[model samples]
Target: MTNLRIRAVEAGDLIPVDLPAPRPDVDGARWRRTRVAVADGQIVGIASVALSAATDSYFCEVEVVPGHRRRGIGTQLYAAVHRLTDPRFPVLARAMDSFPLRRRFAEALGCSVVTRCPAPWIDPPTPAAESWATGQQAPAGYRTTVIGDRPLAIVKDAWASSFAWVHRAFGAVHIDRIPQMWDQYSKGVDPAASAVAVDRNQTIVAFSLVSPDAWDGRTFIVAETAHPDQAHGTQVLGATVATSVTVLARRGTRRVQLEGHTTDRHTPDVMRSLPAVGSDPMDILRLEPPPAVSRGGCR
Candidate 1:
């Protein structure tokens, strides 16, 4: 940690150190602060936190370059986070199951696992598209359209409303964060594969969001949902996914990846039936508050 300075900076400052571009699942407004551990004019570590209005806590992430790790750089960055952020609110962190060292590091930092969610990558058999082909038909009074063809405001609103039906162990998603989330991740979404179901009234009732894999060029179904208010919501959900698959298959995309969350009740059973080829589930950790000291005088 010698000659390292942990100073506050904008989120973009960490981009050089593998800070991912803003993600659609994460709301930019929730970002509270970011700090970089700079040494010799280069960033050696980074720590950032975003506020979850629903939980009233900060979700933090810290990283130290491979060469700089084990030198207390991460610890110092976190200490800087503690010094800058509100102490009344708790801090949370995430650890991927595939990285045992990450979990151990979180545990060593006095964090406890609060939730575990599977990040399964579903690679449906080529025949799955054929078997589910019939699902492409929209329910009566509903028609399917590509998400890119519709207004973003309309799509974002529909996604937020429909997602309310989902139950997650962590907590409900903040509707206010949907727009920014959509803005960040929508750029990568495949306009041709992502579809939405619209009612006769032109209201969006269901949607399937898809994107290409950055590494393999295959398709990845980012998200799919149907508004619970629709009488045929379930069917619409099926149709959207079916349509995406049919289109993908026609394009010679025999394999598709869909991430499933074990703690999410909304994941369809059909999706769960697919083989999980991704890393182990992710561990959401929370830093437990210290025990309260006695307020009364000692006897």
Candidate 2:
């Protein structure tokens, strides 16, 4: 044994191990703090789950230091998280299409492969701009409304449900942790910059969360989307995309990009339905686990 101990992350204890910035929503829900594994008093692994308000859906993230591979730290940390969420609601973890190790770990925990959306980039469409100038109005009802704190919960539920369906169809486990999603979004994106669409009843039908990134040179990244479930799903999706493009253009963004798994044709169709939206291929992989009799259980 490596004498590793798993415990909650404390104030001033986070030292920027090997993962991206700490997600905001996960951190804010002080009750659902992150868990870190340490060996010899040095941080070696980390994992955390953000529990959702609706049902037992939680979003999770895990990271193991480069030097700590092959040890059971990753598994242990995940197991501990599972225990915390066990007998409650199902937990879902989101791994980047490029992170194979994490994906494999998820599978080992009895998670199935889910739907993949492609990450597509969009520049000011010159040809489309010309067409628009000729009176080709932006997609109908494709308007953008600011996302306020009041409507966040509803929007989050809608987003979680949509993603859960897509993942389930692909045979992947679904954990819709709302707090974690909110944390990641709040830290990485600007809420004021995000927008949602509403029907006549003022119900939020669709939305797009966007973040401005300077590293990619004034780029806008569509963090997520939730379209209505009614007959207007396609239209709602189109309006959300068009509204995002308009917002990014006004902010002086040179380009806009949305990242998702793109192996499926439906992914491309979803993007194409929106005016000026284009698709391109991106690399992604899912690693499998060794055959075993025991499958991890979801809360």
Candidate 3:
């Protein structure tokens, strides 16, 4: 075993670190520094947080080298990230189904199991020409359009209103924690890949954001979805999925996969609507300092 050390990531180290494939538009949004764990001068674990401008909330991701499992390294890494967080910021973490220990670790913190589902994968389903054509039919008051940087402000506002329920369901601390969500999206790798549905007045009613997966050459991930209100929820979701399918088809991609918590209820609806996709499992976890302590070090 090597001596373990944890520190903030540096510029030179940025390119080499195996970061989770970012959604296409993350660059426009700002990201906080990531913390990495090194052992014997080699990096072994990593963790970082992202804030969504539309929601003003933060979510975290953490990973550890396979060989170093069962130690408290994951826990320590989580605590370190939590230390830098604002107490009012609602934080979320996903533990893949393969990682049960990580789930337990998250429970030891204050997070509850919000949702779970099979990790779903979508490949070019034999494009049902009829269904594809049907999807192109714009809903009665809504028209589909590609989102551009100029309209990001309106989209962000609508997104916040539409996804507000998600924060309540997930125990998010507060909105406004992340101010760069839409801005980052505006600068994403392929803005053309994103689409939004708007009403007659040109008010954005729904939107979907997608990005290419660096690890899997042909796959693109759906990063975010927002709608004008709950009444239009299903329409927004359907439009988002359809838009992704259409884009992937045009790009000649054969498959797509969306990461979903194994416990979330919406997974079923997602599967039912897009039956061609198959669900697999992923794990999600979150860690926070014990309530009695104000910070990782202590009150």
Every model's TM-score: 0.70, 0.61, 0.65
| Residue 55 of model 3, lDDT score | 45
For lDDT, candidate 2 versus 3, the one ahead is 3
lDDT of 2 by residue, 1-299 (tens): 45799987766665454755444334333336477887888778888766644333556667888888778787777766656653444556665445666666766665643334555566644446323323322245444466745545556765565555544544444364544655556565555556676666666655566667733453544433353234455555545555655656555565566654443223355455433455443332222221330564311
Which is the better candidate, 1 or 2, if ranked by TM-score?
1
- Each candidate: RMSD: 6.4, 6.8, 6.3
Q: TM-score of the candidate numbered 3?
A: 0.65
* lDDT of model number 2: 0.55
After superposition on all CA atoms, how large is the RMSD of candidate 2? 6.8
For model 1, residues 6-96, the per-residue Cα lDDT tens digits are 7866454544545433232234455567778888877777777777654556787778778778887877777777665568767877777
lDDT winner among the candidates?
Answer: 1
Q: Per-residue lDDT for 1-299 in model 3, tens only?
A: 45988887654553234545322213333446478877777677887876643444567777777777567677667777777666775666766555665566566555654455455666644465227424544557777766645544556666555445444555552356333444554454355666677778887666655566633443544433343233444555566556766766676665566643323234345445663545445533334554622333200
Query: TM-score: which is higher, 2 or 3?
Result: 3
Local accuracy by lDDT, each model = 0.63, 0.55, 0.56
Residue 131: error of model 1 in Å? 4.2
Q: After superposition, how far is residue 126 of candidate 1 from its true place, in Å?
A: 3.3
